[model samples]
Target: MWKFYLFLLPIFGVNISGLYAKNDQKIILATYTYDTKDRIENLLPFADLLKSRFEGKFEIETKSFPSVDELILAMLKKEVDLVFISTAGFLSYIDQADEFEIAGTLMVDQESESTYRSIIAASKLSGINSWEDVKSKSKGLKISLVNENSTSGYLLPYLHFQQRGLTPFKDNFGLVEFTGNHKKSLDSILTGEFDLAAFGENDLQNLSGNEDLIHILWVSPAIPLGPVMVRKDMDKSISEVVEQNLLNLHQSYPAILESIKAGWIEAQNASHFEKLTKDFYIDFLK
Candidate 1:
């Protein structure tokens, strides 16, 4: 009878293991990039580093979308466990604030904090100088933005107009257009297709030969950069593990550090986003 009971216990243990396997949870990491195919490939190094360091305790899957709004919707539905989003993308989902928590932020250029400037660049021929000069000369002109949801490209620059006592859509800010990416925005501005465009400081600094054709008309103050976040419903223990590993990734993998262009910083909560939100509002009211 004792042998029979021992055998039964083993059978029950197998059943439980099967059940757990069937319900195994998968972690989905989402990013906002139209070219997800390439982006995911680029992110593989970091993902592999996490897996190696964690010893495959968690499974990670990555997906990319074209816009922040789409990714936010996924987060709301609990379809994504984690995300890499820009400052503007973060703000767009502020109402669902409780749905997520920041896990980490990339420290690009060895800076503990990352900030972007809304640069108003114009072709040398355009002769654009100051903000007032841009306002006066840009009437009926063409302008390009990285995207409608872009912080430096759209939100900050739009708010800049309001600060100057002008309306973005109603005021004579010219035919506003979306260039899809910062490089494209710069291209449009340099090719004479658009008089000027807004870009992050990183993009401006990375520009090569075209630097001669394009000039910065104005620049906004530094604003918060990208953040890595996790869904609120995720396991706290797992989140902490992921965060700690990433924050220390540069120390572990020299290759990953070079590829990502920054080390991981400790994560912050919603309060970290408040300053960015306030900056947007102040710009909006302006």
Candidate 2:
């Protein structure tokens, strides 16, 4: 199981610093959706910040799971100390509330109250110029999608298609591939290997750094970003420090906040997640 877990992580690129916790107090930060080396790199500074904030009381290690289920398993087994999961993944795993607590939710920008979009992009050469070209009237276009468990990458797009009175597999697509990561889906479409790709809007910006590469097809409605969840049984002193630091990240470490697409919010306060159901993503979630 350990070997399989290690194998699930992508090849190393970022150098995660700090000495291993000597008192069995190491903090393992874990995630599953949209895993990439670049994302790891972006989180490195944040890890270092955590190390500094902990004042030698804890160490930080980052891990990537192969799926949301695996991540939940790790949490249940008390292996992963914390998690950065999507809203969809969070809703799915929060049923095990006995094992975890919401540390904080990621705020996508400096101004917004907390919402972001899933973007659909089409290759300029694909002749899919606008939303009209993607409507039910057009069919047989090849598309690449991120994992079914991805909120922005998969669920939002699925919901959009459903509301349009158009079915993805049954109506207007010749091929649909769940490529499992934003980079592959975006790269495939940009290289003309696929006609369309859907992923997080921020992910697209992070990948290209600009919009000149691909034509924007459509943008889904705003979706709430997930929270940073921590293992409930973790040491209270360490968990409190981690939670407080995470909530103050915007001011304490703006660069890290920028890297993860957050501004500022009271992550420790109680939040009302009034509606969450498999209904939003019934086909796969069920």
- Clash totals, every prediction: 2, 0
Cα lDDT of model 1 by residue, 105-207, tens digit: 5544433334456787887767775676776776767788888778888888777766776565536766888887777888887888888788777677677
Query: How much lDDT does each candidate structure score?
Result: 0.64, 0.65
TM-score of 2: 0.62
Least well predicted 10-residue stretch by lDDT in candidate 1: 266-275
Candidate 2: 10-residue stretch with minimal lDDT = 263-272
Could you tell me the lDDT of residue 117 within candidate 2? 68
Highest-scoring model, lDDT: 2
- TM-score of decoy 1: 0.74
Clash count for candidate 1 is 2
lDDT of 1 at 77: 79
Residue runs of model 2 more than 4 Å from their true location after superposition: 1-24, 32-35, 38-59, 66-69, 95-98, 108-116, 121-139, 168-172, 183-193, 202-217, 235-237, 253-286
Candidate 2 CA-lDDT value: 0.65
Q: After superposition, how far is residue 39 of candidate 2 from its true place, in Å?
A: 4.6
